[model samples]
Target: MSTARDYGLDEDYEWPRPQEGGWIADDLDELPHLPRRTELIDGSLVFASPQTRFHARTVGLLERALVEQAPDTREVYRNFTVTLNERNRPEPDVVVARAGADTGPKLTRLLPGDVVLAAEVVSEDSVDRDRETKPRKYAAAGIRHFWRVEENDGLPVVYVYELDPATKAYGPVGVFHNRLKLTVPFPIDIDLTAVDRRR
Candidate 1:
């Protein structure tokens, strides 16, 4: 049978086993030799799959667009985790957080209230999480806006949602095909078709 020795883990290195109540968000920051982009969902560790070219390009494009359009009061972050509670801290592909949330270089997470919008680019390996789980959690955390990007024929189709405070649920705002224009979170316009274009 394969063992920790076979994987180069130290003989004394014990894996962080799941807790009966699930792992808390703080446990992620303390674990040694954890993989990059590891997340906590319902107190369990969730590791990210290898990112694909399409996912990378889409995320880059979105980040650039948001950075250019986001006002000085809002800052854009890529692959940063937002702490929703003690047991949930999921990283979105792109996050537009309030400028005050940028504590410093050493800061590791953002609170939900610091975020204005959270976006995810759907990948084959994360279809369910991106489409269903993450959005549901983001909405429950009171994030104002959410966007899900899907690859359709090598182009990105963005589905936008706005959270309804009364219901604490997301309502479809719009679906952008070639262009994405919005004025709610902030004035923004982006060319969704430029993912494959030379910068």
Candidate 2:
């Protein structure tokens, strides 16, 4: 059976790392060695195995493309943690945020509202959580944009999701191949086709 501890997850990693000895902050040094998995869902931890070669390629391509294409007003993060709530901190493969005013915390470790875009590259073990559960979770957390990178959907497969305030969740759908470009909430333009285009 898989366990949260097996993946080095705290019952509250999504709440921001708190003061040491504060119950949720125990064993800070051991966090890096824990197994990696989805930490956003309640009741159970989402078990994720290591990334496959194609998965790594997808994440790498997206990270590079976003870093190059995102406006200077935005910062992009790859494979880094971000808070979604009190108990969910699944690190999407990439995160894009508006440039901040030196708020001490780096742009990547954001509160629920700071994120403008989050992307997940599909790995066989995590496709469902990435394409389905995460979109709802990100919407519930008030994120504005989300993308799903399909490693198997032909040569240029990408799915983009947007939150529709009328529905209070991610609803607008975009499907494209080789590349899809989008204008973000205020100060950024994103092109995902360069990243998801694969053989």
Candidate 3:
């Protein structure tokens, strides 16, 4: 006996029927009564599952670390969608973008060109998307940097990647555990173990 509110929707809400070619990226903004963190991938709506403690804390620590270390011309955001193209708009767990993309409160999404680095803290339900689909799409869209964070032994382990311009594919930068430090994407340093620390 689940009501619409149980799923974070209005009681009178009616789901949007699938279109022949799927939904365009712009349809996401026009859709009403969608759940939080709804993403459009290949013209289909993808709803986020409930957040886990591990996912929340890892994203929080990473966002905090990035915010503290990011340069004035860069900004950090969480759970916001990036418009990769007409048919794909996926939200990363954490995003670092050029300051110009922060168009104040009314902004709905970021253009691929505006993003500097995109990070995903892997969740059980998102392994396929994070590991296989997202990285490939992000690279194809010309994003320069990407990070995939996984929980191991209750700690964060980061795998970093840099895009190869000629190939338009990501090349492994490094795999970091315990601590994450980088210089290429604006000098980031984070204590991965802080996910367990009291905030």
TM-score, candidate 3, is 0.93
Summarize candidate 1's per-residue lDDT along 55-151 as a digit string, tens digits.
9999999999999999999999999999898999999999999998953244889999999999999988789999999999999999999999999
Candidate 3 lDDT trough over 10 residues, lowest sum: 100-109
Q: Rate the local accuracy (lDDT) of all candidates.
A: 0.89, 0.64, 0.89
- Please list the residue runs of candidate 3 whose C-alpha ends up more than 4 Å from where it truly belongs after superposition: 1-6, 10-13, 102-106
Task: Compute the lDDT for candidate 1.
Answer: 0.89
**Which of the two, 1 or 3, has more TM-score?**
3
Question: Where does candidate 1 have its weakest 10-residue lDDT segment?
Answer: 1-10
Q: Write down the TM-score for model 1.
A: 0.91
Model 2 error, position 172 (Å): 2.9
* Structural similarity to truth (TM-score) of each candidate: 0.91, 0.72, 0.93
